[model samples]
Target: MPATGFDNTIEVVAVVVVVVVVVVVVVVVVVVVAVGVDVHVVVALVVVIVAAVVVVIVVVVVVVVVVVVVPLVVVVEALVVSNGLWYYPHL
Candidate 1:
């Protein structure tokens, strides 16, 4: 069986939630470490964590757009074109 849009959305939401939870845990850990660590070390660690988080977010967005959004648009376009409900200018 093929996966539906709802399944895809659920998967995406799960991934985002997991990422958020991880970020929160890491932030908490960093805060705890900052009290005992040097300021420069804490800053560097934070920079690295932020960069990693940004990269993860970018990857998730790209995957959602390409894997989910683009295919959904194509499927809807095909359906519309087949039913003669709308003109598909590209084709």
Candidate 2:
């Protein structure tokens, strides 16, 4: 016996439907994993932790500039120059 044209078309359609379903499942799984936590959580824990780290670094830099570096610079400038003129007569 030989296959007819209609049978060939039905087989192609079935294959296409299966491929589409598989692709959809894969996409959904990838999205879920990328989120790193459940969808119900309003804020992802991973994102919150990263933001916290950034805030800590910014605070440390601000504290260092105010407490240690700014005073050092002011003292050095006062000792080295006065009235916008170099204190030493010769370079």
Candidate 3:
């Protein structure tokens, strides 16, 4: 039995095809990395915005509690004391 040999044209075509496939894969990977970086930046910006909103809300709540509720309580206590409602019965 005689051995069959591989064609030279086929060998060259195979090499070219392999190189093209590798180049396409590298391009795709680079594009994916760029998109991922963009996504990360957007997410970071959103997180910062959300944190700022939360801080503002907390400050407003603290201000209202300290400035409004405390004064109201003090006024109510004063009125009660002035009306003889908190008198002691010690002789």
Candidate 4:
């Protein structure tokens, strides 16, 4: 079926709005994760985990000390410590 000009415009606008909303959501999530944990450690694991390490790697964030002790290695280098935080170990 042939679409009208008004329909096309609405479709384009809808696409644009969806794209913008997705971008904003991604940025907000990233910012929140970054601020909550250490960016460096998160980069290693590719996710935020309150910046903790295995065998008692405690990192102070804000006014709290987040301790990490990875018990299981789900992925190749991903470590899941306490407090539901996961991170990667240093080489």
Candidate achieving the largest lDDT: 1
Best by TM-score: 1
Clashes of each: 0, 0, 0, 0
lDDT of each: 0.74, 0.57, 0.60, 0.41
TM-score of 2: 0.45
Off by over 4 Å in 4: 1-7, 37-91
* Residue pairs in collision within model 1: none
Report the backbone clash tally of model 3. Answer: 0
lDDT of 1 by residue, 1-91 (tens): 6665554665776687687768767775776676666786667667767876787677678777877788899899889899999986787
Per-candidate TM-score against the hidden true structure: 0.56, 0.45, 0.52, 0.33
Tens-digit lDDT string for candidate 3 (16-83): 55665565556556655676657765665566556555655665565566556876887887788889
Cα lDDT tens digits, model 4, 1-91, are 5442233544554565566556555755767677675665346444323222221121123112111222123232343344346553642
What lDDT does model 1 reach? 0.74
Sorted on lDDT, best first, the list reads 1, 3, 2, 4
lDDT of 2 at 28: 52
User: What lDDT is obtained when candidate 4 is compared to the true structure?
Assistant: 0.41
Q: Estimate, for each residue in 15-64, the C-alpha lDDT of model 2 and write its tens digit.
A: 65566556555655665577655663324444544555565566556556
TM-score of decoy 1:
0.56
